[model samples]
Structures are given as structure tokens and as C-alpha cells.
Target: TQLLEQSPQFLSIQEGENLTVYCNSSSVFSSLQWYRQEPGEGPVLLVTVVTGGEVKKLKRLTFQFGDARKDSSLHITAAQPGDTGLYLCAGDKSGGSNYKLTFGKGTLLTVNP
Candidate 1:
């Protein structure tokens, strides 16, 4: 079984501050997905990076997949209080619908207003 290690299990920053969270693994993945879970709610899919060295952006957020496809990161520019949530990274080893995903413990970020 493969494992994805996430850094900085907890984070607290004031509004407008920027932050970056990372997820890494020794095993290669076919695709990697980022998710955000709000209090008392299920995780929401943020983005999916399939190609090595691929980068995707969502407004003030940027996602990057490492060239080795063994890691990824999420960067938030000028973060807001609304962005406070549990940021999780998941990796998919099998490129199909019938496979399970390995998840990281996640970084719990609290953006103070």
C-alpha cells in the first residue's frame, strides 16, 4: 500500500495572507486530486492533475503536480476567511473508475478575519 504524507497538520493565518500546502509520496500516481472539507460537510473536489508537471488554477488558488508525479501542492494567494477548511490530497494509482484512492491526513487551515 502506498501512502501520501502531508505537511503542517495545522495552520492558522490572518486574512489576506498566503499559504501553500503539500502532499508527497514515494509511489508514483496516475492522477492526483485535491479536496477541501468544510466543517460538518463532505470534502469537495478542488482539482485533479493527471500529467506530470501540470498546473491548474482556480481564481486565487493554484495547484501544481510535481514532475515525478509523486507529489503535488496547493497555493492560495491572498487567502480569505472563507478559505478556511481541511485541505486534503488524494492519489489514484489505478487510472479507472473501480480503484480506491489513498488520502493524506490533510492540513487544517484556519484563516482568521
Candidate 2:
């Protein structure tokens, strides 16, 4: 079975602060995706990384894929109170169907105002 480990299961930071969360695994994946979820709502996909060493940025958020495709990282620059939510990282096994995704335990972040 494929498994993903996310670091710092929980985090609390004041608004405007910055933080970085990590996701790692022993197995290489064909693709990886990041998502953010708010209470009472499903997770919203943030970005997807397929190529090794790929880096993607979305406004204040940045994502990086490991060179070996076994890990990923997310960096939030100047977090806002609105950014408080559950962050998730999911990986797709190399040979699995497109819908088959293995999700990490998730990291809960609270950005206090």
C-alpha cells in the first residue's frame, strides 16, 4: 500500500506570518496534488505537480515536488486569517486509475488575526 506522511499535524500562526508544511512518502507517485478545505465544505484543489523538481506558485502559496517524486512541500507566504483550514496532500500511484488517490493525514492550520 502507498502511504503519505505529512509533518506538523497542526499549526497556529498569527496573520501575516509564514509557514511551510511537508508531505513525504517512500513510494514514487505518478502525480501529486494539494488541497485546502474549509469547515462544512469539501477540499478544494490548489495545485498539481507531475514532474520531478517542479515548482508552482499561486499568489501567496508555493508548492514544490521532490526530485525523486517521493515528496512535496507547501509554503505559505504572509498567511491571512482566511487561510485557516485543513491542508491535504494526495498522491496517485503510477499504475492506478485516474480516480485512485491516496491522501495524507492532513495538516490543520489556524491563522489567527
TM-score top scorer: 1
Per-residue C-alpha lDDT of model 1 across residues 75-99, encoded as one tens digit per residue:
9999999999999999999878747
TM-score computed on alpha carbons, candidate 1: 0.96
lDDT of each: 0.95, 0.95
- Write the residue-wise lDDT of candidate 2 on 1-113 in tens digits: 53999988999999999999999999999899999999999999999999999999999999999999999999999999999999999999955567779999899999999
- The C-alpha RMSD in Å for every predicted model, in order, reads 1.2, 1.4
Q: What TM-score against the true fold does each predicted structure earn?
A: 0.96, 0.95
Q: Mark the regions of model 2 whose C-alpha exceeds 4 Å error after superposition.
A: none
Off by over 4 Å in 1: none
Q: How many angstroms is residue 96 displaced in model 1 relative to the true structure, after the best TM-score fit?
A: 2.6
